[model samples]
Every structure is written in structure tokens, then in C-alpha cells.
Target: MSGATSTGDVLTINGTGLFVDDRGPKDAPTLLFVHGGPGQGSYDFMHAQGDRLAERLRVVGVDQRGVLRSDPLPSGAPLNVQVLLEDFEALRQALDVDSWTILGHSAGGGYAIRYAHQHPASVRAAIYDCPCWDSDGTDRYRLPIAADLLERYGELEAARRCRELAAKPERLDPDDQSWGAMRALGKRYNELFFHQPDNTDALDRIGSQSGLTEDQWRRGVSHLPLLTEMYESKQHLLPELSQPSLLVHGRHDLVVPPDDVQAFRDSVPNGRVHTFERSGHFAYIEEPDEYAAVVTDFVVSAHR
Candidate 1:
């Protein structure tokens, strides 16, 4: 820890050091970010919107356990949903905060929702940013959208393959269809994830300056193939999050299709959906000021 309110720190907890970028006033309503990617560190998030959200909320973004910035999972150690939530609880106690709002982006949304379900008393509200609640659902649904995008980009053959893959009930990752299509797109593959390619460049710039070593950045890969069939079955156990929830989506986000976003909103008892018409998966980077404003407004009201 650097200071009383250090924006960057790697604190040792449970015999493991986890990276955290904690900012904003200690007295402010805290908002903890549970990143997606299962392994994608919070570095990009902290770099993108940490300062902006910190201006109004005590924004806390941590690379999930065994993810970037955090120590790798030890041999014979486990990385189940329960243990991941436990680590957040540990961080809460370490920070001395009673409760805080949580924002989960992409795959992180799964983790955030589980955290809220497991520790409701410690969570004030939930925010889902282009969340992937069901990996299989998203992987399959995104295929048709990817097909459409590929077709628009003039990769006719690849687009056809995407459509074929979308028809199947088992396409669970990029390797299924989008990967082949994206591979065809060559460098332009990144375009499928962004509304504006220029904004993709901006996000890339932030990541470029992330200062995380390549090895640390890639450590979370170990989590991708873990046997979480047990927890994966129960991930949707809390279909209706009781907390005041906000679901944000980019109209152009192919990965988490519009139907899923709509379904998420309908499932929430007290939920609101905000769409960034001009963004893709990363609205915070594509439209930072607006994203921060929307999130800040919802978070402040929810905190009260």
C-alpha cells in the first residue's frame, strides 16, 4: 500500500498478494469492480474509468484471484466461485468498508452476480456491463451477430460459416465460429468487438500503458479450462437479483447480443437498462464521460 488512499496496491491476503487500484475518498460510497475474462486484470478498467468513477464513488477494481496482478493459483489450490467470492470478502474486511456497490463487466458479470447472491448484506447494488451471464448462451447467440458483422465487412465465406455455427446448440467459444471468421478478418478481427475501430485503438492504448508484465497479464489463462461444471450449473441460481440493478449495453456489442441484455433487464425486479448507441463492448472507453455519468448517477442513488 502506498498511502492512506493509495490508488495502486498489492496487498497480501490469505497468503496471496492481490492487485487493487483503489481510488476516491474513503467516505464516498464505494463501488467495487469485478472484471470479466475470469482472468483479465482490472488494469484496463482502473486505467479507463477508475479516475472518473473515483471522482464520485470510492472505486475499487481488483484483478480477480489468480488473475492479472494477483498471485497465480498454487498447485492443488482451487478456483471455484465460492473461493472467488471469499477473496472479495477478504478485501472488504481489509479495506474496512462495510458494503459497496459492484460493477461486473462481461464474464465478470457472472462473478459479480454470484458475489451479490452469496453476500447480499455486503453488496448495495449490482451493475452488469455487457455481462456474459451464460457462457454457452452468449457464445451461441453471438455467432449470428458475428455472421452479420462478417458479412457486412465483405467476408462472405466466413459470414456463411458463422451462420452455420450459430444454428448449432453447442458453439461455446470463439474457436467455434467467430474465431474462424475473425481469423479471416485478420487484424480487423478486433472490429467485431468495437462500434468504432478508433475507440478500439484508444482501449488498446490504455492497455499498452497498463505496465503489467506479459507473464502477469497472461496468468489468468489458467482459469479458462478449469473444471467449474459444478458451479457453472449453479451460476444462474439467482436469476432475479433482488438488489437495485443497472444493465448497460452497447448496441453494437456482438459478444453479448441484444436479446440477452433485454432478458437480463426483464429478470431484474428493480432494474434499468442503458444502451450506448455508439459503443460496442467497452463503452467506458468508447464513451467515457457518458458512461461515467450514467454509472455515477445510478450508483449514487442506489447507494442511498
Candidate 2:
């Protein structure tokens, strides 16, 4: 598979290291893709979209800090909003791109918004797909929409478990229970969020390809409670971002809820939102052609 041959190259930031896999022509307008998951690295799902996107612009998918193929995060680094923002800056600097567009998915949207807010100068435009930003660090953003899915699909137990974990923030760390919870969440996330329920296999494939151990995946998920704070605070951060942006979500997305996405679109000063009727959380993977075309057009149109 073309995906297997695409090895990530290394870049150093703050004397620590990071990894990124590049596709498309060097001269094309750079599109930096931020993959979801504080733990999920840039996988083939993102890579598969490359040729289609590269036809219009350059694309680089980054496996952000502590994820597979990236440098181990610094021992004491807080793994909070500030650190991630800084890492993005470091990435831009290391890549020597004067400006770039960003496309963020799921948790990636939160980071992209934060980075755009903090470094408006470096961004040309941004795309937020199924963003999970709420005011507080709770899964309330997901609950109302996912309620039926949680109840009908027998995921209520898992949903409640996730909520319980969120309620007890201190429980987020590498442990058997936390790992187990993430696995369950991943299974449900695939079914509840993606158009095709089978895409959950992509995560497993990516995990294997990226060489992430079960421990790393679990540890990465354990931080979701801490990270969801950033996910939920769209208003404060979105208003601060001056970059041109596009927000797309699946109408059927029980994960982030299209309502939340629409609300965010109305509020962002220079933003637009598109809904994918057939998709859920993984719209890009589910509706790659439309997703890529809309994003490519948007980014190129916004490029100065």
C-alpha cells in the first residue's frame, strides 16, 4: 500500500523531536493536517487523501506530540493547551513555512483553533471538521446527540463509563481500566461517528503500522479528560482566531453534534460550515471526495 511506504520524517522542536510525513509538491501551498487523538498519529486515512488534495496544493500530515512516530514528549511538559500551541509554532518554524493552512479533525480541531488564535500570523486558513469544542471540559457536547445512539446501540454502558471517567479527571492515566475504556470508546466511536462502521479497523491498522504499543494508546486516551477542556472552549478561542476558516460536521455525528458545529459557525467572524448528511465523526474518511474538494477549494481561495 502507498500508505506503508510513507515514512514520517523527523524535525526537532525545542531541542526535542517530532515527526511528520509529507506528500504533494514542495511548491504547492502547504496544508498542515492535524490528526485527531492526543494519541492517534497521522495515519493512512489522512494519507489516502493526499493525491486528491495534492492535485491542488501541498499537504503535510503531522503526528503531534506524544503520538506514534513523533518524539516522546518531554518528561515534565504539561500536555496542556499551552504546550501544544508552542509545539505547533515550533513545527512551523522547523518546516520554514512562512504561512500555511490547517485542517483539523476531532480533537485536532481544538489544537488548530488554539494555534490559530495564538499565531494568527502563520495561518492562511483553517478547516474544523466535527469539532468537539464546548464551554466546559465535559462530554456534554457529545451527550445530547449521542444519547439515543448510546441507549439504542447498547453503548449506554460505555457512554456512562466515559462520563464517569470524565467526572473523575484524576483517573486519566495509564491503567488497565483506562486502556479498556479507550478500546471500548474506539469501537463505539467508529460505529457512532463514521459513515462506515468498519473504519474502526483503520485505527487498529494505524496503531500497528505506527508501532504504538497498547500502553501508549491507553496513556494517550487517559489524557482526554484533561484535553477535553480545550475541546469544549470554542467561543473564547474561536473569536480570538483571525484566520479564514471552514467548519464542517456530519449532521449525523452524535460525537460532536452538528448543532454545536453550527453554533460555532455562526459565531466565527470569518467562517463557514458544511454538513455531511451521511457522515458522523470521520467525515473525511467517510466522504473523502467531497471533504477534500471543499477543503482544497476553500484553502486555495483563502490563500493570499
Candidate 3:
């Protein structure tokens, strides 16, 4: 039972050791959390809602390969959508899980949708929380608000840059994105993630949680170049989803557009939308109680 139920266990899949925190009763319905930021770890979600959800669901949060708790990708090796999906499949097989309910947050939504499409039999249901289903949609809707915030925060130059980027052709090449301008948005960028600009205590609490080495802490820096692949992939699958899906979006979310979330819901064959009226990008952190209730309710009732 050492590795079976341990909160911190490493599963070596495809020769890379992926960190997995598996909790709750083994026989309960399993829910695997797929984190975003391309290579961001699942610790944030685990720290925020792991215990609450684990009581009635098998909460498994595995930091994607090359991210926080997992092994970093080898130099010169490509890390793309297919590789991530294969990794998840391998991890599932390693855990002896026949299937799982996937909960994808932010950019993880792209991967979740693709995983459900590719392995329909392996996904009982999916929960997309504040999902960034399409990068185009994200920039189209998020940038204007971000620009306004930047201007309000007195970062005029960055605000001008955001306005410029947001006005470009909708399908402009990914290379054309002004990441430097975005970087210039600086600390003001954090305001975009919450309904209450000052309510970002969760970010600090989650980022500073112990147990990761220094190298693991910075794995996302190595993944910056691979995010274009995630963006391109998410743009195509909303129309094809046929499973019972719950799309949760924060009403005041400036990270991913709320309207875009609704559009995604309308496109899916059996998709439903739940808006977190008082939350922003991180609904779980902003409105923890309601977030727990909705997600748990969906997991328990979605397949029935």
C-alpha cells in the first residue's frame, strides 16, 4: 500500500518519472487533474481542492511531464500535444485505471478535449474549469480587458502594446504574438486573473507550497517554446465533443473570455456551461465552496 495510496508517488511512464498524488478511496470514481501553463504542475489545484474533492472522488493530480513534480523533457526532444496525450495514456495504464474523469483548467482544457476525443472509452466525463479552449479566443477577448487594466495601473506602454496585438487579424501566425509586450505587462498581468484585483493570495499560497526541488520549480521555462502547439490544437475540437461535458467559466474572467466559454458550450453535442459569477480565472480559489459543490456535483451526476 506504500505507493498505492501515498499522496506523493512517482510513476515512471515512458522512461520519465511523473509525479502523481493519488488520494481517496481506490474504488471511488477517479478524477485526474490536467494542469495548464503548458508545463505547470498540478500542485495548485491539489493544494486548493484536493482534500475537498477526494472525499467523494479519487483525486489524482499528476504534474505534466517536464513540469513541477514530473521529470523534465530531455534537451532537443520535442514536447507537443501528442507526446502529452501518450504520457497520460501510459500513466493511466500504469495506475491500472480503466478510465477517469478529467478536470482540465485554463490551457489544460485543450488537452482534456483532445484526450476525450482520442480516448472516448477512457474518459467517463470531463470538467473544463475556466478553460482556454482557443488561444485566438483568449487573446481576442482577454487582451482588451488586459489593456484597460494595464492603462488603469499606469502601464501605458504595455497597454498600448496589448491594444495593438489585440487588433491584429484573428488568425495571424502564432509567431506574430508579441510575448515581449505581454512580459512587459509585468505585475499588472496578475490582475487579469481575478474578479477582485487584490484577491490573489492563492497564487502565493500555491506557488510557495513545499516539496519541489529548485530545478522542478523552473520546468515551465523550458516549455515556453512548445505552447504554440497547445494553442493550435485546442482551436479545432469543440465542435466534435460528444460526451457529457461541464464548461465552468468565471464571469469576470479576463484570462479567457466568458462569451467564448459559452460559444464552446453551444458547439458541443452535450456540453453545459456553469458561470462563476464572482470568480475570475481561478474559480476554485476565488469561490472555493461553490467551486467544490459544482465540480463534485458534476462528477457525481454527469454520467448518470
Q: Which has the greatest lDDT?
A: 3
Clashing pairs in 3: none
lDDT of each: 0.77, 0.68, 0.78
Question: Residue 207, candidate 2: how far off, in angstroms?
Answer: 4.2
Residue pairs that clash (backbone atoms under 3 angstroms), model 1: 36-108
Please give the lDDT score at residue 71 for candidate 2.
60
Query: Which segments of candidate 3 are over 4 A away from where they belong?
Result: 1-6, 233-235
> How large is the C-alpha RMSD of every model relative to the true structure?
3.1, 4.9, 2.3
TM-score ranking from best candidate downward: 3, 1, 2
lDDT order of candidates, top first: 3, 1, 2
The C-alpha local distance difference test score for the whole of candidate 2 amounts to 0.68
Q: CA shift at 230, candidate 3, in angstroms? A: 3.3
lDDT of 1 by residue, 61-177 (tens): 987778877778787677776777888999998999998999999877777888888888898898989877665566566667667767877989888886776677653553453
- Give me the displacement of residue 301 in model 1, in angstroms: 0.9
lDDT for residue 98 in candidate 3, whole number 0-100: 87
Residue 273, model 3: lDDT of 88
What does the lDDT read for residue 296 in candidate 3? Answer: 85
Best by TM-score: 3
Model 3 worst lDDT run, 10 consecutive residues: 1-10
What is the TM-score of each predicted model, taking all chains together?
Answer: 0.87, 0.80, 0.92
- Between prediction 2 and prediction 3, the one with superior TM-score is 3
lDDT of 2 by residue, 102-196 (tens): 88877778778887877889998998877656523325444343444565667677657655655664423333243344345444645655666
